[model samples]
Target: MDFTPAIKLLNSCNTVLILSHHNPDADAYGSSLGLALALRGVGKEVVVANQSGKVGRFSFIPGFAEVVDKIAVNNPELIVFCDCGELRRVGERFEQEIKTIKCSTINIDHHATNDLFGSVNLVDEHASSTCEIVYNLLRDAKIDIGKEVATALFSGISGDTGSFQYSSTTEAAFRVATELVAFGADAYFVACNLWASRSLAALKLEADVISNLKSHCGGRLVEGLITEEMYNKHGVDSSEADFIVGRLRDIKGVEVAVLFRKEDDIWRVNLRSKSTALDVSAVAAKFGGGGHKAAAAFRSKMELESFHDQVIRELMDLFEG
Candidate 1:
């Protein structure tokens, strides 16, 4: 990908506001902070801001301490949004501010559903993660590939690719991972930071969440519900509910898996599919949400059973046709 225009835009700016989506995943934080570190390396004034969700386990990634929850700069000369499929992903307040920013904007993302909502959209749907795209951009700018940058990029790749187990893990993705590793990204450190440090409470929450797994289409599609009641009972935050969805996706002969998690009266429907032939993003976009093909999500206000029925109907239609 030719990042000449994106680099020119970044080069022209003095102060830039860098951000990712709310409810950030590793790719979100990694791409946003990776770009932040790269921009800062060239003496650009950069602020890496997020709307919500604690960095949690991703704090091991460099530039974690400097991630701010709000934008402080009055008039940033440039704004770069990373790993967000939609421009409104950073929550309502941040979206409002973005509408009024009269500066060059760059949207960097790997999701196929991205809307190209930037002055320069550096979107590559085939890229394993947004961090992969960012790594190329950094390379285009002749930025140094240090341990910190490598770890940040590697973390995103590990996350979005499920440690290179997902279908999105292409040969190019592996090559990039190899390069990042050679640049001093500690394999032990990344693995430990990503999965080796699960707390006992989190383990219990995973078991509880998995216990609710329900099946549709003769077990071809499985579902799970994590209600607020369950969260309060288990004394677990919403983040603790993430692990069970992938487990559901990996079930033998299951093509799609869904997790309906209730938070503040909203059922954030998380969907996962291991089959590349299955475009989960299409289903998610129908419900006003967007993401990668294998992993996507949407939020619904309908009653749990009604929404579950709707999801089943949609998947059945897609499959039977």
Candidate 2:
């Protein structure tokens, strides 16, 4: 796709506020920080901010120390949103605040559902990850991507593509990975930190999720529940249980996996589909959430039993239709 417009916008801006989705994963951080570092290298002042703040597991990536939880809109010439399908994905507070900001905005994402809510939208739904789009943008801008920048971008691609194990992993994804590696991206470092660095508490939490797993529709749909008590018992947060949904989807004959994680008075529902034909994002969108075709999530305030039945009915309809 043509990135000249985005490149020009970045070149013209002096100060930029970079944001990613709340509860950011590697791809979100990767795209945000990677672009921040690259823009800074070109003498642009950049602030990387996320409502969820810096994730401890991703601290190994360069520039993690610089991430701020609160956005200081402070007259930034430009705002760049990374890996967020919609503006609200940044957080309720940010969404309201950003909509009032008069500055130019850039929306860079890989989700098909992106609303193109930017003065410059650099969205490519076919891209493996937002990091992939950012990588291309940097290359098109003729910006030299150093080791740190490459590693950050590589982490995003690896993450969103499930370390090149997901259906989104394309030849272009592998080609980008190869190029990033050549640019000094440390593949082993990203792998070790993102995949192999889970703590013991996280393992216990995963086991609990498995033990609580419920199969419906004759094993075609699997659901797991993680209560606040379970998180307290394992001393791990919701992020630690992020992998459970994928594991649930991996179960043989399971077409859909749902993870309902209790967060205070509400439950965060994470959905995953094993096949493209079963677009889980459609389900998430019904609950005011949006994401990629295979993975999506939303929050629910309904009683657990009621919500469970509702979701089962929804998925069963999808299955039957």
Per-candidate local distance difference test = 0.85, 0.90
Stretches > 4 Å off in candidate 2: none
lDDT of 1 by residue, 118-177 (tens): 999999999999999999999888988788888888889888898889988999999999
* Candidate 1, position 126, lDDT: 94
Between which residue pairs do clashes occur in model 2?
none
Cα-based RMSD of candidate 2:
1.1
How much is the lDDT of residue 290 in candidate 2? Answer: 79
* lDDT of each residue in 1-321, candidate 2, tens digit only: 899988888888899999999889999999999999999999999999999887788898878999999886588889999998888899888888787778888999999999999988999999999999999999999999999999999999999999899999999999999999999999999999999988999988888888878888888988898889999998997777888899889888999999999987888999999888898888888877878789989987888887678777787777877
* TM-score per model over all chains: 0.96, 0.97
Cα deviation of 253, candidate 1, in Å: 2.6
- Give the Cα error of residue 238 in candidate 2, in Å: 1.9
Model 1 regions more than 4 Å off:
none
